[model samples]
Target: MSPSDVSEADAANELMRLAKTIAKHNKLYHAEDTPEIADAEYDALVRRNNELEEAFPHLVREDSPNKLVGAAVAASPLSKVAHEQRMMSLDNGFSDEDIAEWLARVRRFLNLPEGEPVAVTAEDKIDGLSCSLRYERGALVLAATRGDGQIGEDVTANVRMIADIPQALSGETPDVFEIRGEVYMAKSDFDGLNARLMEEGKAEAVAKNVAFDPAKIRQFANPRNAAAGSLRQKDAKITAKRPLKFWAHGWGVASSVPGETAFDVMATIADWGLPLSPLVKRFETLEQMLDHYRHIETERADLPYDIDGVVYKVDRLDWQQRLGFVAKAPRWALAHKFPAEQAQTTLESIDIQVGRTGKLTPVGRLKPVTVGGVVVSNVTLHNRDEIERLGVRPGDRVLVQRAGDVIPQVAENLTRDEEREPYIFPDHCPKCNSEAVAEEGEVDVRCTGGLICPAQRFQRLAHFASRPALDIDGLGEKSIAEFIEAGFLESPADIFRLHQHRDAILARDGWQDKSVDNLLAAVETKRAANAARMLFGLGIRHIGAVSARDLMKKVTRLEEIGVLAEAIEAERSGIEKLPGEEEKKYRQRIDAAVSEVIAIDGVGAAVGHSLADFFHEPHNREVWKDLLKEVKPPDYIVETRDSAVAGKTVVFTGKLETMSRDEAKAQAEALGAKASGSVSAKTDLLVAGPGAGSKMKKAAELGIEVIDEAAWADIVKAAG
Candidate 1:
């Protein structure tokens, strides 16, 4: 629906979800250096948020995407540094019209005569980690990342190792200056890094008496990610080993001004032994600026480093200062970004693939087309709602962009209006004939068959053998599917019994004595398993590798998962249908009967509900019992660093204005506190915000200490 058509309540809820979603992506891209979505997808979400905010200006969220600059640097091992001048990100534009409008705005802001010439400097914006290098007495002293614009992680030792960054100035310079630049890895260097990492992984596997599996090796997805990961290392040695390079773009906190113009200062930086963009030049008019942008795009493929766009800024420093800043970007500068690469193709058919979680994802089979030199045959339709939104049917023409890591993304359905019939989405699982339903407020329809469905079973079994889970060397997705097709594998327990079918396996193609031996031996080695990995492998909802590990830190054995599930069920059962008892009393009767699982650090209501649902199912319980009988997973015992709230149960309620709910949970975990969903008698503290409702009242009645977001932030800062 359009922004104008959406209800205020719906818009508010969507904006809330969008804030959380965008925050997650920001953390993945900026902090983790492992992006989960393509740039186009991320931009689409931001654009949607902007539209909603525009339509409902009164309902703008405090944690809106507009207010965020970058991600926080709190989780890093390195110490933090505060930037003297905020390292701002440039606002982006995609078309020549946008550039013209920006120039018009600049002229109007300065009250300049129409048709007068304005000098604007254009430079390549390389995709890399933003770093600020501070020099005192013409000598490099500190290097920090551009985290959240204000505070950043200190990487002084790491930047000193980069050959491109000089330890000291070459000639005359400011006594105190900070040069802001991009720390990047060239395409060739990135390829070499990935190759080296894979070889080292192989060597380590061999040393551990395990078969080599190249698929298990972690690799940098792109040059940008490689550069970020290399520079943010805890060890300076690792950064020195990486082929990291830098180019100066701007300056900050200078003791004195170097030049009157941006171009002049950039040249001074280059003269002072820092790398500057070779193509940097001043443009006299909008046409010249746009031409330079097009020229850069034409030669982007030949550039040594990855650059997403060209940045243009007012040449005169006086004019820039006069224009001043917007919220997160300068009013005088704009980034002209290249559009995502696209190709026209026909949507031949749509196929639904069920994931381990039973999520039904629609994939569009396309006529073979080339996009940015890569041949694409498939496009991800995302979900059932996306299919309906696109109004696409079989044989419709569509535009596809090469965006995702594995497949192209469906950009638009060109023949939507010419559709003969609307394609009907399946209400039942295409793989198992089981009823599939989309949960309320959810876009993706999922099969409720759980473990009984063959599709879910195959997916779940494959997940159990994945690198982060069981880490079986020879077991892969295709091989697992083959075993299932042959009826040799019924569940995860069947994996351990594979040795019994040795002669049967040998009769099949691609089966050898050494290969089969390696596969079974790999399974045997994991008999003494890490309980955390085992729990993650079970494909339980809301329990990821990290959360599984967090939960295991409290539990002695994997069997407690079922016990916790039962305790949760019993608590809910007792509360069910208490006539004349309001929803408030159900929570008030919180004696010792409440499940401890829900109160465990990092394991809250969401995870407790998922565990309860899993254990309540007979098929899931049978699979769990059979799998445990085959493989003996020992207790998960590990140490967590102590903090102020280390054994205390804490509850967060109401609208978190500055941070997302997930981020709040992460902070609680980092502080070694238990983040619980419900406020019970055990809750030591209640972090409440506006609209706290029932939880806040309960906390008051229970006499728990209440604090707001700012207070919680102080607690986190104190812990740090």
Candidate 2:
């Protein structure tokens, strides 16, 4: 329920509950470093707590979590280091308007006029554990983890193992310096570590003569957790095995001045063998800083390391000294954060979905909650094994994450104070009365009823007519369901034969004569379809629209793809049934075919396997042959038009206010232009927005045409 819907008494009760719950979570996150919930979900809890407090101020507790900055440091075996100068946090700004106001407030505090220029340096806020390193007389003295504002736990031995950390400074070193930065694990390294751990667990289990349990493996929730847990290892040797990296962003206490500006000091640190973020930029205007933030956001997924936001700090030391402290945060620095990618909500129930391939995947039906600005009511549980690993149950408060800044998934289930029953895996398919079975070494449980299953039938037909596929007009989820139930549609081929049901469709509720005509016209127009679209419409497992396009780029006709699939399957089967030397030749043949198919960008081994499996299956083969009888899709072809950007590569950066990035790319492609994400030497044109940063600068440096949305529109019109 919403805050406004709650009564005063209920609000007070909830406030008390939230206060206690948040306090526990704060201790778990800050002190223990073993958070039970995600950062986004914790933020939601705190936000809800604040809302409750606002609604019922009279019930404010003395032990409220909001009143504290950091929790008391938990006692550790390592010696503690008292900070000479307290390491404070930075306040967050979520939007450009908030950043503008923050800058204005900074100017006011510094007693500077509005016209006076204030330069700031922006750095990527690495999502990792913060550590402080002390150097004395050009030698590393100590290293400590930021336990609290005042003190930290010494981890000098662990720091000495990290190659990124400097053991001894160069000739131009400071007499006494303390540098602060984040210790993070790169995504690639993190994955490698997880894989190694799983292998080790399996090896150890084999020695002990027992089955390997996935729960026994040390699997981290994310890269940050992996880095933190690695750095805090009691044995420095173990820490060295974990691929931990560092980036020096700021400083704690310094005896001698290394540089006059923050930028210069960071440069000096970088020269001392400490890595710094390449995305860092020095800006003289608020627009530049905001632009850098936008650029960083767009490139977040591509970066080697994870970053929660960007930190902007006053470059001038004198100005920073003037704007000192605000309780627990620095007045000169601000962290501009992106939208929350995780949220907490009640798990109403668990539902099982049967995909087109008959794979039974569990989905979490969640109470409506907004995450990453999207209201999500359901999240993928992935598989039964994943469900067991999470240990989630109905009515549990689960933390849902928008993984990869995209698909919503249940990350964790916060164990409640009370006992609850574990969720049971279904033995039969939920949509159809068929036994569900899982093959040996396979994670997913699938229904045995193949195409006869109602669930698979609906899903396959819907996918065939989906926008990313054939894109049939007047055909949506509701219409497909209604038509299927009315016995008018059974197979994808039935869609092309819908002309025979014109009178019946017209007589149905909400169906008019014009709508029927339009639907039939749309279907008729798509009879001559593209190879990629028709292939995607088949809904083969692991064959998405992008992969279909990639496959078609190499093979023109659907028949050729089918033949390639058969050849690959034949080679693979022969290799699998034969032994060492005899199978080698067959394996080489399989590899040759796979290599050719995988040579096409975006097509991987899994896609190749799925394609082969689809063609090899008798039922699917029959369906393909039957469907081909009705629809004759055209061969893949490239049509280059006579336009200004016909053979040119164009790069787009920053927010496109008038149109979406996808729409802009589509429009560019429609004009025979190739839309590229990055600015390079090959880029002939760059479309820059109000907050365009590095891309715009690169375009100018490369002498590329940099145009705004309005100018892009004029060019499009001229090309037309």
Candidate 3:
């Protein structure tokens, strides 16, 4: 509905709806590193909400997104830190008219004459995670994320590992200096990381005697996500491996200013062994500020790091302090954001791609169009609902967007002619011709063909040989695809039967005698795969590594899965099959068994149902029967240990001097304890480190026993 035709009640309802939507996007962008909407689309929503509120001032909601800076910090292994000075967001101006009005407002507020100069510093606003670094006596002390304006995640250990972040500042410095900036991964570095992941994946595929699938490589959605996920790692050693760089943009909670103006202070910061953006410029008028924004926009694609906008902050520190902030944003600074990169292209067709989980995703094939610096020919339609929302057709001219990552998306349908009909979403599995069903509360339509679909074969085989599953050394995705094409392997059972094709594999083009020997040897070693790994390798829907481990802990033998399957099938057929109390007893026993399976951490009803379904399938039963004949998987077992922390949940926090957090958790697990990642009522112990914060506090509040590193070491010795 148009804004002009809306009633006051509708406007109020829209405001509340927009508030919730914006808040959800904030969390997705800030905490999850996954944003559903582009920046331009988000801005448009905010603009519309603001306009509605303005039309009816009394209808302005108290929970309006305009009064918010950032999303609240999500739960993490990292301890939390409260900021000494709140981090504020900048007000945004999108167009020339918006910039002009902003300047006029600033002039009016400051009561400056028309000809008087208002020095502003225009700098590229880095599109990355915001961080604050505190230095005490020239030594780096603390580092944190800008979460919810007030509280943030303490990532000092990870931050120290960044090469650009100095352990000690050079030259003269304040007793307590705080440097605020952005942590970003350069485009080249991001590309290198993805390439390395792909190569590693390919190597693993070849090791498993399978064909490598480039599509199986894992990649971050964007460089910003790569930086955030790397920096927030529980293991600092892992963070150190990533290529991350920092650029100082401003300061917070400082003892004293380094220089008189923002520009001067930033210069001083650069002089003191800190990196600053070279595109930073000082402007004397609004026209110069706009020109600088334009210049930055033109050079954005060429810049090594991503930048969505240019920031114009008042140069004089005195004026900034005088202007202060208005709610969630500063009045002394403005962010001139560039419109999202979009291009008009003809959407030629939509194709369905089935995933390992049997879910179908619609992909749009489009006429090649250049967006940002990349040529995009394919875009994701997301789902059937999204297709209906866009009213898109095969011949429609759609607006495709390139935000981050290499994947393009159809942002809007520019339908000028009514000659084309709306695209019909598929009702049947495109590969297997099975009925495609969208389960309750699910956006994806999945095929019920189970092991029959040809498209799912490669993925299922890859999963069987994945690191978390069987951990086959030489097998990889590429070799699996090759083997499948050669008709040498069909199912997990066929993996063990690979020895029969030894001579055939040796005759292949890329096959070497030594490599083939190694691959066969790896397959032989996995014949005695651990029960948990064996269960995970089966590729049952909803059975992740952790869930498989948990389920194995409850049931010892592979045959127990078959027994449980029989019980569930009997119960489903009705207890009338049994007579009198036998029926009641059987029903009780089956319920107890199912409950035990569901009791495992991360295993819910969906997972339990999927497990039962797999076991009941006739084809799956035959496959399992064949697999069991070739491999005698060891029964799940827990060694008896005399330790205080045995069978207990232990949470580790802060920095450990003797060992990394990963090592500490590994040690805890070795002692028969569960190494949990968060604090909870079930936690029997908290392993507090040097800079332990929220976890320690919560443990104390809950009266959960807290032990330092020394005590933990003593416990380890005693357990040994």
**Number of clashing pairs, model 3?**
23
The whole-model lDDT of each prediction reads 0.81, 0.77, 0.81
TM-score of 2: 0.48
The candidate scoring highest on TM-score is 1
List TM-score per model, in order. Answer: 0.56, 0.48, 0.56
**Model 3 lDDT tens row, 511-574:** 9999999999999999888888888788886565556776777778866766765655655445
Q: Write the per-residue lDDT of candidate 1 for residues 133-249, one digit (tens) a residue.
A: 999989999999999899899999999999999999998888899999999998789888988999899889889989998878878766787788899999999999999999999
Least accurate 10 contiguous residues by lDDT in model 2: 58-67
| Candidate 1: count of backbone clashes, pairs at least 3 residues apart or interchain | 0
Candidate 2 per-residue C-alpha lDDT over 1-720 given as tens digits, one digit per residue, 9 for 90 to 100? 788887544454455446645665666666666665445555667668767766655444434554455555664667878888787766667679979988987886666766898989998888888888999987999998877678777899999999999899766787899989999999899888888989999999999999899877867756777888889888999998999999899998889877789999899888887889988889999999998999999988688887778899999997786566644577799988776567889989988888777888787888988774335677778689988898888899988886222336787788654488888898798878789987443578988666678988888888788766888877877889998998988888888888999999998999998998998999998888888899988877656565677788788887677777876687557655457686645544554556454565435445666678778778788888888888777889855578988879988898887665755775686577778889999899999888999999899899998889998989888985
Relative to the unseen true structure, what is the C-alpha lDDT of residue 228 in candidate 1, on a scale of 0 to 100? 87
Output the lDDT of residue 328, model 3: 74
